[model samples]
Target: MNAQFFGGPYDGLSLATAEVNRYGRVVSKRFKGQRVHFVLLPPLADWERVRAGEVDSAPKHPYELVKTGDNVAFHDADVNERFNEILRAPEEA
Candidate 1:
């Protein structure tokens, strides 16, 4: 699936699964009824670095993209707790 992102660092980007993983992971799948949330995070560089502890993959900005089907919405969220919660959440199987 491809989602269009607006606001934050990834603004104006329309990315696929592979491209999206470069910035952050899909923390939520159908989180709020057909909506997928992608947390905006710090530069990860690569998975090797992520496993090497060389990159901090934490939320860099209070921004995330919520995609519902083909439509995507960007939010500048202030709730850190929610970000952390979703960050640790497993994608729905």
Candidate 2:
């Protein structure tokens, strides 16, 4: 799977490609050709904040693209059921 973050007046949009590897691993790769940019975080900072009761952000996986009237809302599910399914699938050898 390819995942990429797009920014501009339209930010926070991500593009991804999903594929199953010969070893049966579902892989996602960022669309590097799009040249999208994303914010980077310190690896351990999230864990520390979570333990400190300051991790109030939603999980960053399994997001849904919702369209309502003239507006679009991105919703992230608590658990990534779809992503899990892809990961668990057996790849073609």
Question: Per-residue error at 34 for model 2, in Å?
Answer: 24
Give candidate 2 misplaced runs (Cα > 4 Å).
1-60, 78-80, 86-93
Write candidate 2's Cα lDDT for 3-36 as tens digits. Answer: 3323322235443322101111222422323221
Which numbered prediction scores highest in TM-score against the true structure? 1
Top candidate when judged by lDDT against the true structure: 1
- Per-residue lDDT value at 85 in model 2: 50
User: Where is model 2 poorest over a 10-residue stretch in terms of lDDT?
Assistant: 17-26
lDDT of 2 at 67: 44
Per-residue CA lDDT of model 1 for 49-90, tens digit only, reads 654667656646545666577775556443555566654566
